[model samples]
Target: MKIEHPAPMQWQFSRRAEQLQSSVIREILKVTMRPEITSFAGGLPSPATFPVERMREAFDAVLSRQGSVALQYGPSDGYAPLREWVADHLSTDGVRILPEQVLMTSGSQQALDLLAKVLIDQGSKVLVETPSYLGALQAFSVYEPEFVSVPTDDGGLLPETVAPIAQGARLLYALPNFQNPTGRTLSVERRLALVETCARLGLPLIEDDPYGALSYRGEPLPKMLGMNPHGVIYMGSFSKVLTPGIRLGYVVAPVPLVRKLEQAKQAADLHTSQLTQMVVHEVVKDGFLTQHIPTIRALYADRCQVMLSAMDEFFPKSATWTRPEGGMFIWVTLPKHIDSMKLLEEAIAQHVAFVPGTSFYANVPETNTLRLSFVTVPPERIRDGVEKLGRLIAAKA
Candidate 1:
């Protein structure tokens, strides 16, 4: 122990690992964990949403029936039956996909990681929404790509605005339905335009949709993959509908890219958990999702209504936020000179927590912006939480 190598062996480390950005949600979670605090910070599904009781039953059944397979190392591509189940569940209208197209992941987060590994080189140009998923930004940042933010509005990303920017980008990443942080969904017409434009520009699209199944308003829009299978990597997750604790998600990409992602997954994590896949396959086998998902949607819809009502009643006239139809988060922008990060200390003193919005951006950040999550808390607490945030703002004024 006393003997040390000359110069301490120079302390080897990868340059890529140094550039990774920590998630703002995590920091906010720490602040919210105090017993006095009410968290509107994490993009979490409600504990009420987790079908934990049934999943215990499902897990037991899976373990009993396929004990060896459940515990053993498995193929990187994913469990065949689980892939088949996902493809079948995604099938709608006249569109369909085969199981061969699916690649299971630890979570959709892993899909973002694999995409970054396969597609990005240092200094590659990447396009993202002005207010994007912080997790996606963090995952992709490790590769050290130059990023550009495309402007967005309540209608979601402006297709025309991004088309010009797409001219030089290697990949265009978006969370089209109930987008994280902003809570804006793209119009169907705009979604088609995005697919077509990206195809024309040769910029592969990573269409991240963890919230699509949770949408509580309007008829479902056809997915980008359903429209143009060859051009988009459509990522899906069970975390929103089932339970996030299981960490099951998947991606469907074109054959060539799917192979590359599979290899990358093997290199990165060997494979996603087979036990979880077996559990998921067992749960989905008997049409449990048909009964399960609607419960999540209805509960979230009621929570969303509670948030809107609370915002209307309590927020300052100078503050404005999105009126989202579905999903966990709502984006808020304060009057100029108000910094959400700075306000967070006072907000925590008031026992309410929300994420500062700068964390979502690829470049320049808006000091006025913030993100709030309504999915995890009770409807009454959402009312109380937003009211407290309003009081916090008024005190600053």
Candidate 2:
């Protein structure tokens, strides 16, 4: 048999393909993978916190007890026992969540993608927080939604910001607890006001809470989903608490919306991996997270303090940053004369790297801002990295 070779033809791409943009943070993270770099670029959880032994045991137990089910395909809605566990875990005093409302996803990233697939359309208005999660922006942008970023403070998005933008918006996406890029948590008072305002405005809220479990104080605030169950769509993940390798995340929304998301998910990847789902359920169903999570909290808290102290001692007076109670990151604002992207080049040359905040903006980016993740770097290295970054900033200033 002879195979004939044909001339290469020009490929035409869709408008959506033209709209697709690369993740700037991820691009920088690739450069930081070198062993010599002390990186604060990626929002990576500490490897020391993974429950390796427990996961191994869970894998063994699942293989021994229900090998066939573990390896077989699962419902797009998710594993029943896992869904029940999610509902029970997130259900609070007055807010009742049912297992049917929970849909398991490959990760929170997939949840964002699925939500965008179902909820977003061409030229749809999507509200986002100023300096929001870059991944969310990337996921939503592919659908060609007009992103409007609401102004934020240390307490997160202001309620007043929602009123003007809420009229024709499809959804308001926010990270209320230890927000990514900027480690600001939404205040309890602000949460109440924002939820009330959105409810009154008839705007849907997409609350992404991947880092809620990592709070150092272990004091959880009122969730928007709990406040206005009908209006808020909640997303949660085990990536931070357990491990990212399993790639498990879940979403709790109104049933009708969940059904639509299920359909979208079915087309995407059929369902999340059954083996990982069963293994995770086996690991957490035993109440292991109760004791295990506190250890992670303590470790992260210590690391956060180290980074803060280092910043205080080494950074210039013109350089300001957030003091977070929990989560993996700290947001910094350098002098107006300095650009974070330029600083990153110099920092990487000095064996240090961080993500510039330009990528997080949906519009009108502030170039002087940057994000530094503290959880993965050790105290001594964090001190050195901060010092090097500070020196670079001072020189630029």
Candidate 3:
């Protein structure tokens, strides 16, 4: 028996598994979780804005009324009523979305995965804005596509520059309203031009709008999905407005693509949680978000202003940052010599943390940049964190 021992077997993973890397922001968040840390690293919505009472009531009602159905497995596409609700909610005067076109997922992040799975082949040319959402990049990279970073300015992705590089591209992804890392909203003029350009080139566009509803003013800009319903795939999430814990997000695309995504989703998870879909539908079906979203906007607006003011007062004159009208993030650019990855190490020693901009880029990363999220932190803590970061930058500069 002693001579019959076998050696340990080594597991072989696929090539795609090797390409996957841990999210830098997520890793930083683990360090920031310490109570002493004043973290602006996560794009987490303020817990104060969560509809605790309403969510409680909704969950109770669902359990009391339709407990069996809520607990049972749901359609792969999603709960029927919730799909209808999303379709109706997103429908505009010019663009009418049918219930058939909606596919609810665990979150928009899952939608990104499904889209990549369906649309991307090996070496597929996928287009993304320079410094696009890190989550999107992480999702897309799993499929091993060739990511082409399109140029962007303050207003967001450049439309004119798109077509030239757009040749042979599988799809163009953009966050037209309040982008994640930069918080730069695409202008209406550029939005129109971008849609038209994509249409002319027969390129598909992925419109990810998690923070669109968080606009400081009550008004959100027109969605690209409204411009070219058939050509664009729109992804929206309740994570920013409602609580992220339940994990509900959706996609509105052409019926054909919706079917394909549904098939992919079925293969992945079969469906998003039946209870979560029903509970959220019960909450949002009767115009709850109409009143609720405004509260979030106001709180985030105040916090954003506080952070901006602190940056002005504390940050060095050599530093520059985005002035976001809405959303949780502000992208900061320090002097070119300063690497934000190293700066984050110094910041953690001072009990503060942020996501370095290098993770946000698909191709050439700008190491001098970093993203700050203001919503979760208190105003005083926001100021303290910004001041500490400022002092650090001043020393480096």
Q: What is each predicted model's overall lDDT from 0 to 1? A: 0.87, 0.92, 0.93
TM-scores for candidates 1 onward, in order: 0.95, 0.98, 0.98
Off by over 4 Å in 1: 1-12
Candidate 1 C-alpha error for residue 84, in Å: 0.8
Judged by TM-score relative to the true structure, which candidate is superior, 1 or 2? 2
* Model 2, C-alpha of 169: deviation from truth (Å): 0.7
Off by over 4 Å in 2: 2-5
Question: Residue 264 of model 3: what lDDT?
Answer: 96
Candidate 1 global Cα RMSD: 2.0
The better-scoring model by lDDT among 2 and 3 is: 3
Question: In model 2, what is the error at residue 352, expressed in angstroms?
Answer: 0.5
Q: Which residue pairs clash in candidate 2? A: none
Full-model lDDT, candidate 1: 0.87
Q: Give the alpha carbon lDDT tens digit for every residue of 21-98 in model 1.
A: 567789778778787788989888898878888889889998888889899999999999999998887776777788
Q: State in Å the error of residue 183, model 1.
A: 0.9
